[model samples]
Target: MSAIVNRLAPANAVVPEQQPSAVAGLRLETRIVDGAEWDRTIAGFDEVCQEQLHVFATARWPSVKQEPMLFLADGQVVGGSLMMVQPLPLRIGHIAVSKWGPMLKDSSAPHAAALRDAMVEALIADYAERRGLMLSVLPRAALETDNSAYERLLARGFKRGSELGFPSRYIVRLGLSDAEQRKSLQQKWRYHLNKSEKAGLSFEHAGPERMGEFDRLYAAMSERKQFPDHSAYDTVPLLMALDIETLRPELFFVRHAGEVVAGALIFKAGDRAVYLYGATNDTALPLRAGYFMHWQIIRWLRDNTRAGWYDLGGTDGFHGLHQFKKGMVGEAGVITPVPPVANYAARPWAYLLGNGAFWARDAAYHIRRVVTGALRPKARPDQAPVVVEAGQP
Candidate 1:
């Protein structure tokens, strides 16, 4: 397929400066629908999320049938949440999961508590009518403390789980303007950024037409890093298509010399922008193209948009990558806890078994990678493709 390329604005084109805004009110709503409806909802949500950095837009519940309940306030759709159920065999039961929201604005604890109450009430009402739903799980965004908002939910009968499954690194705030951003970075990172700039690295916005460049870079990294599954790269086309069709090209950026060498995929949900996917040529490491790419993207958002937090996604708590992201800027947010649903009713049991089977199927992915690597010879470096799909790079 021919790639879609967006023209870059002329160097002299005027780019407006960004200004910060205060928080706004909160509102809530719910929409229940089947697969088609869910898909449409997700697409719409994706557009908003890509611009806003809200987490609810990215969270997918495993279910053939789904109902998305959204939260709005002050006339703006601030949150997208849902209740999902998965079917199981032998009449055991179904699994239920609901999220309150990717609460956009930071509100007072009382206001947040009220929103949680309303969402939980809606969930209970929906759950009570369903026979197969044995247990319901809600993965809320992490908060800093045991406050009234959380306390209210627990008081309302929801129990805290022992484990936090969806723990995300907290928001890192890199100030607007390249100079200010550079000043905020640690001395060593700043040194690398300077070195990268001296190497003649530059960044550009990417679109569908240039997706091939992204794909090539991503595939090269995947092979070198020995990534366990190719699906991470496979999802590129879909995500890029989604980005373009939704008019959110700011979600993607590429760094290059005369040709693309490294890139990253970013997603904005609300006031948050997430650093999602990235890949670079190992040859570009010394130039620190990755560092330059990240620095530029963060500066753009900080200067041109209302985004407040940049999520580096997930990482091994103590890994080098995690530490690198930490050094970028911003305080860490709460770790998302994923607790098992406690209900053991037959319906729930069936759902778990079936879902577990699906999980096992996914787990086999690493083994497949191992076999594929062992059987297929590596492509010669000289024969590497010039362009690849979008998100992969």
Candidate 2:
């Protein structure tokens, strides 16, 4: 018997609510992308915005055995869908999952709704025809207060699943002039920047050729702290490969005695720039290199890029990290959830078991940390200069 059978009986056993054949007075167009073309389509989309969904698809598409579809309406591309066929170890058939992600454009318009409905219908038909998937998971971006998409999904018989954690991106408006920008900073932040400058710290831009230095500084910091290993740093070759791509690496390096002491990596996409990575040398603590590096990047974005915002990505919910980001100019924005799906035969059991397992693991982790005092590590002063170099631009 399939593990799914041992888990939950097929979804068919549970009758679902009937949904309207159309929604929001719009029609959608959906098609499948297979083979090598999937990568190209994903890469093309990445040029517009580097959302995690696109990145995940790009990285895992080859192995995921998924098909991509683009939704169109009135000859304009409105949204897209990705369906993955997953075959479990003990399952007899593949489970199909369709994520309602990486929305190409605004989904609020009446036309957009029609397009979405059509796209979703096409996806369902495709799955049913392709030997039919056991279930589909769709997650939409929580771009606005309206939960129209969620309601529509519910109407179509999809159940609410686990809430996925997303980075609360901090956006700093960049239209302000230099003086205005400085004034906009929280008084303490401004004071620190000025103090760092007065303490003899200088900043410079780094490129691909200087990546080795950046890696060394990052490795040193990681060794000193209990943080997840950043894939970019662990895989230098991947970072170098990105250098050949279109990502603009605006790496700011703080220097003392003509040596790198700290650095921040800012990645530009369209009118926005994101603070992707940073590292510093322990010996350069007095100069407040990290503060200077951040300030320098903000200034650079303000003056040159004319970019609208600088994103300080990721925070541990409303914790200290979130507070630091909140201190910046823009307000916090939430990302939508990315849905997951298991086989219909396993869906019910998986839902119950997954939630229980998640809480249990979290509780154990907390207890272990509390007992070991692992959660209360003393904050280390930033010291370390990051060297910056880049490949031929």
Candidate 3:
């Protein structure tokens, strides 16, 4: 009863003989799809990221046009991305952005490298060479290291930019046994976790109806910290309201003295589960509710989901927050994302004008941030137990 269907290329289809070895037997297809179908198709993939989901993209970029792209080899769908297309100023062309995607059915497969290369080449051909748009791709944070996909992108003339999709983050590897996972925590972190367990706190898997309560907690925390509200609060409700199971977030709450003290929202897609937003009130710090809340989350992910890694999100520039996350991630889980890369239009003038305008916009954005004091780093209270909600820094 699944909506996904595999379509073969026409009999007269031309093979990409001149392209890289990976491009052979690989075909990329684009289709206009409804929301249900889009969700169904992508959900079937092995690694689905929130950014590549229909609900997230529609909520995150309401104005930009979204296109669904599918990758196939030997007539079977293997990978795809929900691409966001933005028109350049003065009608120069367009900028196609793909964030944290195109997800594959099995990134660990033997043919993954070649499939990824073919996807990159197809992306360039469709967006840059044929349609004459700038194709900008920001791979998932985990792909930041000596990734073959990134190297392939550079080999195909994609220019690397300083903009990163994710800053340095901490991810807990969930493959460890429960005892080992706890032991992996820093000595102090484990001590506090034990203390929190004895503090008479309770944990619950909150339902979508509790989103209003979460928003209230988040709003109060943002006001108290005087920091920017980077949580996905605006989009959480919409995603929660959807029928699509892949995009629904898992909400965990901690209660002390019969009152909610802390809560964390996590989204799982593919093999990774990410901490989207977390909040704690003043009462939470005293009870060490944050520690209790995260421990429960870790245990839940390990017991329930197929996810192998849990991202703790970013810490921005807060020292205490960074230390707390580092303790949770241990030494081996810290990761710095690769910077975004862009493939420009085939025409020289279009590339120059388009690149110039994009930089101009970036400069203005930084100026605005400076004027608004958004770049100022606030010191986290030494005893603060949990990280606030985070997004791209």
Candidate 4:
């Protein structure tokens, strides 16, 4: 199997200047940022995904070298990204990847589009041309009527890449009033929530100390359904224990008869909150605890984080999970992120080889997941599969 990466630019497209280049009055530069500095810088952005956070990078790629780059205008920060770089064999070059960035300070401003282009161009100048690295970016643009960000990447000689596994997410706008939020729920979903409320189920915003309870429920559900446990169990505790108050991940649980039956781990950064992982046992399914758990988390986000959006994460081709998420956010909330696009930089041949290796490895992983899932034994008639959202690194 060949590892595939995003496609490269047309062989004839002229590469931009390799040095620091100003675009639309924005100057791009790199900085040596500690955890506090990284957190403080990203706090001002309007949209920040968990992948861009320092804790996430530390936990997901502890051994990889990370670079923090910022886009400044008039000596003020306007955009930034946290990039993780892995050196290719024998110093041929490095493969640099940025997920859900470079995030802009104000994406709704009149000059926001131009600012975004400048950020992308600067990345190209520094990583691709000057450093001769293969840079792949998952730009933080939604699948919306406005696609200028996607277009800009292509215009700048980036090659389109595969989804790398996840293609889309369902994001619900959280700025709505409580009444409006409920109104947005699909009719059947609303009904389930109503029923769960009458079922004597108790929802709590739990702390990291209750992780033991969550682990037990998750393990029980996994065994009952005979499915692989892909939850971020190892990293959840670390995120939950972060010293930063606003940046810490939240753990929520739903209990029936004083026993925990379901749990969810959510991570928030900037104005966005993402559903990282979830699990429910048979006891929870009957009570519709999943719906109730998510609702409580949504309300908590509204009151505490003031986050503007909630991402339900990827559904992993599970029909039940897709239907479940669609009921909460509706079809309109579904969004496919821009696929990772790569710039070959100065060493086009090196980029091609590195991306090829990545593509092959990703393809093989999905194939194995499909095979393993199919071979799992059927669950008991009364049991339902645990709801696990596919999380990104």
Of the candidates shown, which would achieve the greatest lDDT relative to the real structure? Answer: 3
What would you estimate as the lDDT of candidate 4?
Answer: 0.69
lDDT digits (tens) for residues 144-260 of candidate 2:
444455556566655554443432345676777778777667666667678888877788877778877887887788777645442444333343445224343566788887878
Candidates' TM-scores?
A: 0.66, 0.65, 0.86, 0.83
Q: Which stretches of model 4 miss by more than 4 angstroms?
A: 1-23, 89-92, 141-143, 164-166, 337-340, 377-393
Model 2's alpha-carbon lDDT is 0.52
Clash count (model 4, backbone only): 7
Tens-place lDDT digits, model 4, residues 112-206: 76666667766776678767778888775464644556656776768877554445566776766778888888889889999999989988888
| CA-lDDT, candidates in order | 0.49, 0.52, 0.71, 0.69
The segments of candidate 3 whose C-alpha lies over 4 angstroms from its true place after superposition are 1-24, 30-32, 143-145, 374-393
The TM-score leader among the candidates is 3
Q: How badly does each model clash, as a count of residue pairs?
A: 34, 24, 0, 7
- Per-residue lDDT over 311-333 for candidate 3, one digit per residue giving the tens place of the 0 to 100 score: 88666545677778878876435
- Assess candidate 3 and give its lDDT: 0.71
